[model samples]
Target: MSERVGAGKSGRKKVRDGIEGAKVVELRPKQGAASDKAEQDSEDRRFIHRDNGIWRRKGDNPPTFICGPVDVLAESRDEEGRNWGLLLAWDDRDGHRHEEAFPRALFAGDGNEIRSRLADGGLTLGAGTSAKAAFLEWLASLASEQRARSVTRIGWHAFGGQSAFVLPDETIGEAGERVVLQTTEREASLFGVSGTAEDWRREIGLMCAKNSRLVFAASCAFAAPLLGLLGEEGGGISFKGDSRVGKSTALRVAASVCGGTPQNGAGGYIRSWRSTSNGIESTALASCDALLPLDEMGQLDPREAGEIAYLLSNGQGKARSSRTGGARSVARFRILFLSTGELGLADLNREAGKATKAGQEVRFADLPADAGRGMGLFEYLHHEDTPEAFARYLRTATGQIYGAPLRIFLRRLADVMANEGEDELRGRLRDRIADLADDWLKDYPAASGQVRSVAARFAMVAVGGELATSYGLTGWADDTPSYMAGECFHAWLAERGTVGRREEEQAVQQLRDFIARNGEARFERWVDAVTAAEAQSEIPDAPPGERFRTQNRAGWKRWVREDDGKSAWRYLLTSEAMSEALSGLNQRSAKAVLVERGFLLPGKDGKIAAPISPPGHKKVRAYEVMAAILGSDEGDR
Candidate 1:
């Protein structure tokens, strides 16, 4: 039998045996109907659909669906014409809600993009490759709808108590016993609400009461919230000393009164001096009506040091330009910041070869970090292992028990103002501070006006501490705070010296230093000759009686006479030499000052140069400076 391929009625190829005339039937492939149904089910499972304007998972019904309630708070279109939305989403599992900025393109993209973006806002969607597409489609539809109206931006009074106080997590207001308004967006976390008022008193409050330096630092921190009401300008207090001396630790202790950590790591309260001015500006705003702690003054650039000090203390940010070249809103803050450094601002500038300005010194008042007696930044460690160990303990303890005292203080101040009236309370506090200032300045009768102002600032911090104690916030004896503050302020004043005389003393020291350094190398003096004849010939004779008879030259006679043994060794500095030696001052002015002070003698020609040596070989006009004036003692003056 010969086999031939033939088409069967079922459209299958068949083999026939020609000799036997018998045909064989073949089976054909079946249609994939079940596989198609399975794929359809998967696609349906992947795509998330919306029910009643809420997104629902594929298998979820009424009770099983996640109820996150992602609300579109506000919407805007960027320059690229892409829509952007600010969303406040709630996570039921975590019981936390966070605000996020979402772009429309993310929702319009694949499901993975949608899932990833929502996940960033703390939302987790059901997992599946096909589910992402459905979620993305649902998100896109949601984005197309009308956005919720933008709520009015609340005006926050950083320094004064108002109906509402804006915090990191919410806006706490006095609508009915301090309601938490969770709808407002917080741009910066100046203050927070954590722990309890009692916890703060136990941890940070008691610590400040025991340590005078910590008390002053914490007092400065507390003063920040009342700066506006107090009508005081913003400024910073720097604790400066050697490395590992607990300067930064003291600042951290102060920072704990608010929301900052005392640890020296990421997200800790201590800020570095190496940041740009703009970064510092933002930091100041973030610390509005609170404490701003800066660490490591040695890290700051010398050129920007003065500018940063002035900017921060001035309570304003550098004006910035917007995209359209228009002026952006200036960032402002009124705060009392604590800073740490191995060197004071003046010494730091001097090391960089820059002169320290007086204003810069006043702006950042430097207090010695070492409290003396081998205790760094502390008079006693409150019976802890060591200062370092105590500092470490504070760092840990404060991180947990912070942010409550500030709220209580504010609330108490508000209540006082409401019951007693704003002006009365302010006047009473002002009088108390003024009395403290008088006590500090009573002994410093000749204190400069600026010194009085600085003393007042220190007094304010002390008074604030006393007030906190009076309010039962700090568990300290009533009189202890003021007494310690006065003692500390007295020490600072003594270290600062007579303020108005600082410039004069510095100038005199500079002149003395120049003379001492170059006395042998640059100055000329006639030594005693081998014989009296030689000495007599080398010395110039008095010109005439008329030389001593010159008018308006009273001091000339005393220095121009023939040299006695005591005056014979006096150094003669020429006008050119004097100019070079006193380069920090005008040549003529320096000579006049010396003459007026009786250190130099005036000449018959109404000039300052006197003839101490034999008309020196070149007949140079020179002045005679008493060797006593060039001594190290003169420089100390």
Candidate 2:
């Protein structure tokens, strides 16, 4: 048995070879240590005395018991062995126990924080700087007998490693060995476990039946841990709609899968979108390899909203300079986020006066909250009569029974991975996802690669939900997860309009918007007939009919006779203007899209632009945009 020491007369023999009054914890090394190292280990564990689970130890000055009980548990180092720390265990006055890891860096400070942390954790240090310094020194001395020994490593977020699925607070799969979780500080509300598996499965889990959004959101939580397993990149799903539409409730449902469900925006498993860029990065790291539930898109700064979408979906953060002035790798993580907002990402970007890119759209797929059933965000209310009542019940149920399903699901995953190596598990998951996606895509045979990719993501969520159900954690039917996920995917696809040629569609929309906004004001009209056209340059001198002009002309417009012999308004744009209209797209490719759609009439030279002479201007070649741009033009101009 390990050596046990006591503090008072009942336990006293002598204080010889130790800090005076406290009984010497006999010099005994942990088993398996060499004689010399064993002797050293004994010294490392010196000065600790436990009295009925109370940690007490004497201070240096006056040889007094400055404080009762100082217990330092096992030491820990990061997996890379770069940072070292120790796990501290203590009991509060109420007999409640607590354990937390403190990095050595914390002790290197002025000792105030260490003492404060202990005090905050229910260990009140004795008065005086000596007591504080001496107490801290004694705690540091726990590492004094550092004989070279294999130290356990820690990770910030070790999920989906090649060998195991690990989390900062816990591991999902075989750890191969014990590893401590060393994470940055975050809010008290996040990542906390409460309630039981049965409680959650009975209440919130059962309520997910026939509820597509709830299941879809909850599945995203499960899918987070599987991203690394399936060799998938990080991304997210956004549920956007008006307030009281149950969007936040969906977020809370997803949040329940990971930990405690805080009231929306009060922040726990569900975080507010109102954070700085740095704060968002920290939040991402806090929820790494887990579902990051963000509430309220309206809260985020419009300018930063779209940028953060790219940031969260990209799986990394901004790099910073180390104190030494050298650049260090910025924090990176694998995260699956579920968000709720009054507006979708594209509209949010529009608020910032920016257009949403295709990649951004792919990274964060937006699904409308309205189910189109006249019941906001729900197809069937199950036992409830109204969506509001349903949402209220979910909020109450989730608050009671959250932070359990995650453990149950992860434990099952760990068990499976332990039996079959993680590699095999990953392969199995990939195969299942592929099979599920194939089934989901049977109707959209011509889906774009991007569409397929998004489909696979939704499919992954479905598979995770179904797997949880199969594990008996969710108590859901076998086909429920897939059906719910399908409902969401089809809704997103319909919102998107076309599965394939999304870029082409976007290009057409871009042109349409540009013309709609700029047509009359930016396009200079050409004077008809030869003499009037030649007189256009002499705007001040020419007759009113000949002096056609426009302010800041982007290009030109004219009542042109089409091949079909109908006179309609046509927009003419220079190569530069066309490029401007199709910013962020391949210039030539966008033009080809226009031609293919009969939106553009290419010249005989096979170039996008055709030669056109405007009044008083040189016959500068310009792209003749079809009158269809205006949708309908009858040469009234």
Candidate 3:
């Protein structure tokens, strides 16, 4: 048995002639001064204390742990008796130190509770690469079960700042306050003991959902096989699922792994790397040490699809800084994890079941399930106890999983992208998404619209990017020349693609055919109502002393006040009708009305009307013409 040390004690002890301490512990190395100088010295290793639940010797107060790793064990109790578990373990760097264990929890209840707690807490789980993979595998098993259950409505209860409950109230026995159980243990125990088959099924289903989140987090952290596709050369994993499936939560966890936040807006994207408050941008995502989690990707406009694709396909690229005098070529910010909802891809051919057709097999892929899965784990790992612990974990872990000789999972993703065409790959994605949605809807009826909208947005992004690529321009930006290409594709798809070759020709032909059958009179009336209004009226010259005068009219009446005490000509002036008639008239007619009626006047030869300008120098005719004829001309002149 390992010797127990008190909290206050501080001294070294002998371990096979090695040194050990209550706070700063050490062990003597076994050695006979021998031949080979190649192997690293075993005795050089040291262990220090840490306070953040990580392994540490008692004496050390700094955040840094010793070069050698230490183990962690914790304890908690609840009404169902004292529950204990071996939560985590940290192995030595070289795998040579003596194994260490600590009491995780102590139960104050009956012997039964003590026994149960001991049983639960006895397992001394390690915290290295293989352990994380095993945890993910276990989570996947739960996900498979969750996928099978069709029931809907899952509630998430989050505790922030100060909260009364640590574990679920239902699971706790009829004990007084102060009794607490580790959330994991409580959840697992309740899952095991649920009574009826239906109850058990529900339990199983929820477990699967929760487990999937954990698995996703673990896989992303370790760069496991299931997550290999995320780091591929031109490959990305998208989180597409119905609302409340924890899609955003998963991406948040992924971002946490990269020390990032999933936020929107210029400051969030452009300045994420500089502060904790800001979120990561597509540009910053590329530099992340681990998978870059992008959330709410479907919110991007059709114009942004190309740049998004470039960031995903290429691990690195360039962006123009939003900051003034920003350089043209900046480092690319690619994403390892991309998430969205309501993405729809439809190929007329696919719906028709014609594989060989030119455009029949459009495919829409839903967000990846892992997004929710990862998000769940993030919640569990961080809980409410530690602020930004997940972020710190990600900062340290990204280098391990994403840098240097990249993980195997990333390599697999690269392989898949290299072999699959865009259509084929997208089709597979669509099918997966459909399945996920079908599952989600069983629990949430309202989720369908939200899911579909997000799905459509995602599809638009993809199609838009493809169109931009064809145009020989790269990326999404408000000012990029290729920005509108993707938008055009979206507009085309929305209209189901017109039968005519040209949009103008289509409109003209549509009008012509309709008019030919119905004659010009009906068409004329329809145009008259929809077109801008027009009218004509007479105006009086300004009073002798004033250079200019104006009149305001309402309906069909002109203001003829009794104050004049004289008869005046009633000018038949146009009101709303000006827009249509002037639009139909030539430039000269349009200008004449505004100037003669005092609505607008020329200031000399070319200048516009101004407070200090010469009487005729301000030319207000063009301004009137522009206002009259420019109300919504589908055609740009």
Candidate 4:
């Protein structure tokens, strides 16, 4: 099949060329670092360049040949239709045939001229996008093929660097063992071999059956050796599985070997602000360069995922500080492994897809069979049968430090936090610690000591030393709080004569009594008490009819009558009275309230009740004219 390339942006062209009779080779890079390296390699493979470098298969055989790392260049026209500088190209390798047309057309710049303008840097690749997506997929496919051992053998060359030959375990036997084990250190797996004494599968199955812990340890050791294949700038691994399959343990071993922290050692970057005399300083990922073992990979917070994704894509450090301007250049690292449990296959697919897009290598570790069938994965890790064994394991792992900066440098790190002011820095640091706890650490102690070793490698210095170390502040020594507390709890159990004892009946009664008392009282109150408010208030006040004011044509005449030798009368009336009087008028007429309030007047037909304007036609404003003006002759009376 003709492999597609450059799905998103036209960053570069995808050239298809034959390697020993039309074998399609795809080169791509993960997110973060310059993916253009992948594009350059891809172009070199497509068209046969005499001086180009690539891994070529000889005579369609299983074995592959390591070719040169060649330069690729693209020719494009400027706005005015003039040919511009060579946009992108792979330079010719030494001791290879150089095609005149390919070099002349593509690499037109003088070697000296091109070399002079450069200050020891080449063109960088942009972020992961639709255009560069095809390259990402193709690279992932190639890695997957190697990981699955689909091809008989593959030669991998580090971009801008050296090359190595990778072959299946079937072809490479262990130096000392009667049988070889077929397994990847970069992956958490156990394969079964039926026949060959040189099969890696047989060795792994034996180690797992004798002690899965050894298998876990070996997996970590293997990953460490393969770190070089991960390369600089971009690339990482993700360990995925349920609790207690030794995911963290594997990476912890890797960290111990490499001398990096478990928490910050690998995976992504952690952003923090440091206080200095001038102001606050910030550090990202904190110079962590070791195996990262991320526990509970399933439940990461959105922000952490974003931070991890960013680092994986851009190879740029990210840090945000209020005291400082904003994001300062932070250090970036790769994910060594991610550990999780009880995640849906769908969720795993989504997460893996995202990691692949960001150029990350992720492996899903299944729960160990022996542990899985016995007492569940988590229970097996903490089983009391091997207390001394686990403790000793922890001591050995904690003694080793990885990726920790020198003491002198840490003071500067402290200063960065100090400049931000102790309180602010401490608060953020606490929050960061808390996030790691909720996201990864909660299920930690339940993980195997081997996995714990990996986690300890990537953890923060304070946390790793204080919590995970046997020689540090929170070690298993008699003086340490955790150790003392565990000892005290064990003692208390012994004092109660509860060692291997069953108190099920007493516990059941206690539970029943507590629930009957507290639970019933709460339920009664909730059921009996009113739960909603009344719709209306009960307070008494004036009726709407009595509080309303009346008016007439002269002005705002009150609804009062003058006793000037005549019956008491109203100059104006309340709406209720008006309606009642109109009903008793004894005449057929339609009653109309003024659209707006107005003074009473004679009739248009000139009848006394046929309202008409007063003679002078003196009209006050509508509201004023509507007044019920009542007058009296009290003096004459």
**Candidate 4 lDDT, 181-235, residue by residue in tens:** 1111112111111222222222221222223333333233223222222332322
Predicted candidate 2 versus true structure: per-residue lDDT over 192-228, tens digit per residue: 6778878878888888877789889888887787776
TM-score attained by model 2: 0.86
RMSD to the hidden true structure, all candidates: 13.9, 6.8, 23.3, 29.1
TM-score of each candidate structure, all chains considered together: 0.67, 0.86, 0.24, 0.23
Residue 427 miss distance in model 1 (angstroms): 2.0
Better of 1 and 4 by lDDT: 1
Per-candidate clash tally:
5, 6, 66, 75
Cα lDDT of model 3 by residue, 519-632, tens digit: 222211111111112211122321122133233321111122223342121212133323322332243544454455343435565533222211333421222211112222
Per-residue lDDT value at 84 in model 2: 73
Better of 1 and 3 by lDDT: 1
Please state the error at residue 562 of candidate 2 in Å.
1.4
Q: Give the runs in model 3 whose Cα sits over 4 Å from its true position.
A: 1-35, 40-277, 282-331, 335-413, 416-624, 630-637
- 1 against 2, candidate with superior TM-score: 2
- Badly placed stretches (over 4 Å) of model 2 are 1-22, 26-68, 144-169, 184-189, 261-267, 530-549, 633-637
lDDT of 3: 0.29
Candidates' lDDT values, in order?
Answer: 0.60, 0.72, 0.29, 0.28
The number of clashing residue pairs in model 2 is 6
